[model samples]
Structure formats: C-alpha cells, structure tokens
Target: MSTLNKVADVVPELLIGAAVDVVVRGSDSFIGDVLGVESRYAQLGWLAAINVVVWIIESASEYAAGVLWRGLAQGIEHDLRVEAYDHAQHLDLGWHETRPQGTTLATLNDDVNQLERLLDVGFPAILQTVLNVVLVGAVFAVASWQLTLYAFLPIPLIVIGSLVFQRRLEPLYDDVRERVADLSGALSANLSGIATIKSFTAEDRERDRIAGFSIAYRQANLTAIRSSAAFVPLVRMAILAGFTCTLLLGGWQTLDGDLELGLYSVLVFMTQRLLWPLTDVAEVLDLYQRGRASTVRILALLAVPVAVPAGTARLDKPVGGRVELRGVRAGYADGPDVLHGIDMVIPAGETHAIVGSTGAGKSSLLRLVLRFDDPRSGEVLLDGTDVRELDWDSLRGSVGYVAQDIYLFSGSIADNIAYGRPDASQADIEAAAEAAAIADFVASLPEGYGTWVGERGVTLSGGQRQRIALARALLRDPALLVLDEATSAVDNETEAAIQSSLRRAGERCTTLVVAHRLSTVRHPHRIWVLDAGRVIEAGTHDELVAQRGSYAALWAVQTGEATA
Candidate 1:
C-alpha cells in the first residue's frame, strides 16, 4: 500500500513532464494563428483537456503522498517507542541502580516523541521536493541545454546550501536533543518526587532547577531555528538570481529566434517550480536533522547490551536450600569495595540473620546471592552452583526475596499475592496470606483478596505492605528465602507476628534475614556482624553475644543500652 501510494505523485510528475513537452510543441504553432486550421483547433482543444486532467492528477497524487508518508512514519515511531519501553523493563537491577530513572524515561517519552513530529512533517516535504527537482530539471534540459544551463545555475547553490545546513544543523540538533532530554529528566524527577519537594518546602528550589533545564532547551532550539530561518531568505535571493538569469537570457534567445516562445515559457515555469521546492527542503532538513539526533539516542538505548544474560537453570526443587558466599569481593562500578574477600556458608534449614550499621554492606550481600549483580571477585553459590551461571529466572524462581522497600504492583490483593506465583489458586493465596498473618485483614476488606492496592501498594499501611510483600514471597514457596529489613518499619506486634512465621519457614526453605532491630533476629541459629565490608564476627547468636563484639555492640545500641 505504501509503495503504491508513493508512486501516485511520481507517476503524475512523469505524465505532466511528457504532456508539457507535447503542449509546448502544439502551442508554438497554434498560439500564433488565432484562426488556425480546423484540425489544429481540434488538437488545441484536446491539449487543453489534457492539461486540465494532468493538473487534477498532480493535485490528487500530492494528497495521497502526504497521507501515506505521514501514516507510515507514525507507525514506525510508535513501534520504536514500544520496543524501547519493553527493553528497559527487562534490563538488570544493576543498570537501574547505575543510571537515573529520569534519564531513561526521557529517552522513552520525549526523545521518541520528537521523532514522530519530524517524520510527520519532514519526510513528505522531502519527497515532494525530490520529485519536483527530477521533473523540472528534465523539462529544462529537453528545451535547450544552453537555456537549461542558465536555469540550472542555482543547482549547486541549493546543494551546497543544504549540505551547509546539514552540517551546521546536525550538531545543533544533537545539542537540542540533549537539552530536551535534560529538561525531560528534570521534569520527571520533580514530578515523581513531588512529595519530597513539598515536605522539604523545596518547591521553589525544584522549580528553579527545572527552569534551568527548560531555558537550556529553549536556547538550543532557538539556535537551531536561527540557522534555519536564515536559510529561506538566502535561498530566495539565489532563486531570484536564477529567475533573473532565465528571464534575461531566455528573452534574448526567443527574440533572436534561437528558442521557441512556448519552450521558453515552460523553462521559466519549471525553473521556479524546481528551485522553489528545494528551498522548502532546507527547512525540512532542519526537522530531519533533529529527528536523526533524537533517533540516535533512542537507538543507543536499544543497543545497550543486556549485562545479565539469560541463564539456563530453572529451579526444580531445593531440598536443602543452602547458600554460601566464598571469597566474595564486591563493589559497584564507582564505589569502594562493599564486601571484601568474605567467606561464609549457611547450613540447610537454618535461619541466619545479619546485623550491621549503616553502609556496612549487609544489603549488597543479598544482592549478590540473588544475582541482582555479580560480585567483583569470588562466587555466590546457591545449592552448590554459582548463582551467576544459573539461569536468572530459575535462580530467582527458587528464592523468595522481600526487599527493605516492599514493592507491590497495583492490583487486587489476590493479584499482588500471586505476583511471584501467578498460577497460585485462591486457596494458595489465602494460605500464603495466613503465613504472613494478613489473611484476616484480607477477609475484612470490602472485596477481600479482590481489594485493589493503589500504585506501589500505597493504599496499605507500612506493616500491611510488608506483610503483602511477605505473602507474595511465601506464595512462591521457593526453597531459599531472603527477608531484607523485614521488621524495620513495622510495630512490635506486627514484628512478632512475622517473626513467629519465620520460625516455621525452616521446615521448607533456608531463610536469611537482614536485621536492624535486635529483637526480631535475636534467636537466629547464626548471626554475622558486618563492619566496613568484612565479617568481623560470626557465630551462633548466643556465642556472638558472649563475644561482646560488633554484633553485640549493634544489639546494645538498638536495645538502647548504648549510644552509637
């Protein structure tokens, strides 16, 4: 359909070119004799009819070309946007951690959107200009090469001007694209953190921050527009020069009987049509250059390699659910080592707890075992296999993780609980809820498990959100479990309730908990005290307490028996 539609305008251009040749030949003889012979009059009438038909054909083709090109361009734009979004979500947690969410969002939304605007207006203009050039240049060459040479004097100027515009505009457009992305990033960050802005009474401050980016973007666009605006008047002057050359030179040829009057008329009309159309291309090139800049960003985003390749292992069963980290040297891309040459192992069916002060690398430890990121050196092993080598889906499927910040996709209670175990039945969901001690609360809801939790589970209390996240993990029934900061934000009663459930978790899977409050993890079979990225002490909770070291110190501090 698109190719056929593209042919529409081009076909008429050919027809018009051929008709002009025939019309020039006919008009030369009949135009002179007002009382031309009968057969000649008949031919003149037919030529008039042919001219009318060609005009209609040209108009219809142009309309068709506009619709087809614009529609196809939009389709391609939307496809790219959807693909970028899908790929971004599939990327690793490490990628998200390293880059700002606002930047990626800007590429997906604003950058892709810019391409659509360019394609919608710019591509059709290019097509019309190209066809006009071909048809007009052909007519000029056929009439007289000398006259054609004079008419064609501006060809190199148009070409040179477009090339100059392209070079100047390409980088200007790139800067414009970057500025737009910066503005979008700033806007997105402010909007997402609007609550933080309000709480700090930093609304004015954020507004200033956004205004800075907006001004940069506005200035960048103005720079590009300024270049493009100069293009027209300059091209118009060149066009005028070409037209003056044609008028002065062609008039001499006609008067000297060197060229026919009708052919001269065609040359003048064709030259104006050809050169005028090209001037519009300069403006269209501006749009095309901008779109090219925006597309490169989008394409670069798509080109980002998936750092964590898909693994082959799928969790079939974890009989023991043991975990071990051996010679682990871990750090992020820019940071100092968070964990250094750490060796530790958890026996199957044991509930191990980790305690540490701020920036002690406790959470980073779990991330390695979960394969959210690979350790810089050494191995994170689950069930005797390096977690990195295991299929990500399989490794993750076999382990249930509830992070410090409990996350829930917006959905009904049943939907959120079934997040990890999508195939779980209502009975399974209720059972998982019971395990987390939120089943009764679910029953009391106006819609029970069908109750809708707003975005990120905002409708639920902190404790409720934690339990829902817990239930979500429990529903998966993975052989290994990591409860990270499970009891940090909950009340004592809720903590106790969740703790009671943890005591029973050992029957099925080995569980590791990252503990901050002392009471929740007091009875773990093993407790490891981490300080400045090393395991300074590790033993049974009772033994660690006897040592009166870092773990004991943290315990005392949390229990209010000591300061810091």
Candidate 2:
C-alpha cells in the first residue's frame, strides 16, 4: 500500500518529463519550418512567439516536477527511518546484542539516503530517456519511415548492453553497500571507544584498522566504477551510430528529393533527441543498482522477527508486583542455558536479593523478571498473570530497572531523571533524586538539576551516572524495582546511604537486587544464593550464614576470613 502511494507521488513528476520532451521536439519541428520560409522576418516573429509559450509550460512543469518528486522522496525516507527504529526498539536484548550498532545506523541513515538519491536523480533521468525515445521515435516515423528505420539499427545493441550492465552491476554495488556498512560500524565503534584507545595509546593501531576498512570501501567503489565507466562509453557509441546513420540517410534522401528539406531537418533533430539521452543510461542504471542493494538491506532488517511480541492483554489496574518464576529455564539466542529450571517466588511489596559468583547467572535472573530475555522452559508471572500474556507496555512500565552499565543521554540532569516519566514535575523529579541519594550531589553542581551530563554522562562520575539512572527509574514509581549492581560504582559511604534509602523505599515496592557485596543484600527480606546457574540456597542472610554453605562461604570471603 505504501509502495503504491510512493509511486503515485512520483508518477506525476515522471509524466511531466514525458510532456516536456513533446514540447521540446514539437518546438524543434516548428523552428525547422520557420528556417525554410521565404518570408523570413514574419516566420521569425511567429517562431519567437511559439518559443515563449513552450518555454513557459516547460519551465513550469520542470520546476514543479523537481519539487514534487523531492518531497515524495523525503517523506518515504522519513517513514522508513522511523519504521526501522520503532521495530528495533521492540526487539529483545538477545537480538540487539547479536547485531552491531553501526550496522543498524548505516541501514537507517546511509542506505535510506541512497534510495532517496535514486529517487531524486535516477527516476527522472530514466523517465526523460524513455520519453525522448518514444516521443522522438514516433515523430521520426511520421516524418520519414526510412529515416526512422535506419535510426533503430542500434536499439537492439543498446538494449542488450543495458541488460548485461545491470546483471554485472548488481553484485558489485551490493559489495559496495556491504563495505559501506563495515566502514560505518568501524567508525562508530572507534568514536564510542576513543577514550579507551587514547588511554591504551593505541591511536596508531586504531588508525591503521580504520584505514584498512576505508581501503576496502574505496576498492569496492572502484570496482563498481570500473564497470560503470565501461558502460556509458559503450552506450554513447551505440547512440553515435544511430545518430550518424540518420544524419547520412536523411541528408541523402533530402538531396534526392524523396524528403522535404524542412521534414528532413526535423527527422535529423528528433534522432539526436532520441539517441543522446542513452549516454546517461549508465548513470540511471548505477542508481538503480545501488538503490536496489540498499533496499534489500533495509528490507532484511525490517523482516527480522520481533523476538518479544507485544500481547493483547492490559491490566485492569496497576499490578501489585508479585513475581514468580516457575521452573524457568533460559538462555541467550545462541548459547546454552544460563538459568536452569529455577523455581522462585517473591511476594508483592517484598525486597529480595540474588547473590552469586561471577558467571553464576545472578544478573540473568533479574533479566527474566524484566522480560529483557524470556525464560525458555517456564512462564514468568506477575500478580498471577503470565508476563507474556500481559501488554508489553504495562508489564515494562510497572517495573523500574537499573543495570550495572549506566547510560545517561546527553541532556540536563533533570531531563535524564525524567526520561522514563516525561510528564514528571520538577518537585517529583527532585523527590526521586533525593530518594536515590543523588539530590545533594546534583544540588552541588553549578547548574543544579539543569547541568548537562554530556554524552553518556561523561561529565559525571560512574557513581553519579548510576544514581541518575536510578533516579530515572524511581521517577516511574514502579510496582517492581530491579537493580543489577546498581550501586557498584558508589563509595562504601554512598552505598550505605543509598541502601538505607532503598530499604525505606522498598516498603511500597517490590525490590529485586543482584548484589556483589554481601553487606548490600544482608538486610533484604530474603536472599538467594546462586551457583552454576542453579539456586543452591534460599533464605535470609543470617539463615544461609548459619548453614555455613556457599552463601556462608561467600560471606566469609567478603569479611576477610577466606580467600575468594
């Protein structure tokens, strides 16, 4: 349906190109007759009058066509970009993790722009060439069929050459598109990791790496260039052959008195009009191949299945946040299970902590609750309703998640805090910041809440970024709050303060924390000890310490009684 709308948008502009060809060729015939008239001054005046009318119509149509076609291309590009982004946002983390950010950006920006360029230039060029052929060929036939027949001698060769050109250009242009994506990915990665590269003194190494990718991109373009360069000249030769035959045959026929001088002149001009536009046929085909390549990439991305489909159900009211994982088994898209058949339940309005060794799937548990990655073998339920059966917006909005890797967009601190709840008032934003124990630090800044955080909160400390993320999550006033190493960057004193605040906040919300430091989890309502993707023990911190098992062993290590 959208394709039809897009074609409709561009069709008028194309038809105008055909109309312009008629005016151009018709004026040529008029001027040719004026040149032969015995009343030269009178004929010249009439020719001037005809010129003014044709110019007015031609200029108006040409200008409107350019404006209308460009507008159509822009609208399509905008829609495509938004569709790609909206689809990407709904995909599961597993899908996002498998792809490069650069590849996605390249498809959204570069590939979409390529198609736009095709529409802007290529579409009109093709229309003009076709119109010239059809309109001029018909006019030539009427003037003299013999001359028209001679003019078509090179048509078969041009058609065959174009077919061969397209077949060969497809793969070469596809390669060029792939190389462009690689270059985009490499550049994005380097820019994001510039600080790391500088810290490690790997500037030269990174430069060389980027240069290699650049060379590959250039080479791909050159290969396409080599092929395209050969095309226009060959097409021009075919065009020249047709033009020469018409000129010779029509001139001979005119001298032999078989053709009128005025009619012969018109035929000769029409033949030039038909054949010269073929010289640019190569450019039109180049755009076609490049646009075709980009369209394939864009379509491929759109076709990737949404890993987490939004369900049709909505909550009658807000959920009470009772989360239960029933015999849940889970894994990444391409990996073995990270969370085994783990059955657990956290009652509404309770705080629970998950502690495990590195790679013990402590974080994975929180992800399951948030539905970042779904369980493979069992359902994750919230308030007795399977999360998959709930509307994704309602399920996600009811949970406030803060991960170990904090991401704060470039904006004022207040804006970042209010990101999850854009309608939050200044007072509400400040209250959430206070609850997260970040209000004092924010108030100390020169701009207070208005201070810019820079890209990814680079102006602030890691601890500050985490606090801002927490404040953002807190602003939602979610029924369920999930923190995965949320306070890992804060100092011991700040951690203690935040933990105390969290304890008070948990009274109204269900809190789940993946803890690295035992002290942080010790005061939670319940604590679970995970080992090798299995829940080895579940109880209060004191209960597990009494058992003197894995939890106790970890506590001992943290307390300096055993080696980690």
Query: Which candidate has the top score in lDDT?
Result: 2
For model 1, residues 497-541, the per-residue Cα lDDT tens digits are 888887887667889999878788888888888999999998887
Tens digit of per-residue lDDT, candidate 2, span 507-529: 98999999888988888889988
TM, every model: 0.88, 0.93
Model 1 lDDT-worst window of ten: 1-10
Quote model 2's TM-score: 0.93
lDDT to native, each model = 0.80, 0.84
**Pairs of colliding residues, candidate 2:** none
Error of 1 at 373 (Å): 1.6
Number of the predicted model whose TM-score against the real structure is largest: 2
Off by over 4 Å in 1: 1-68, 313-320
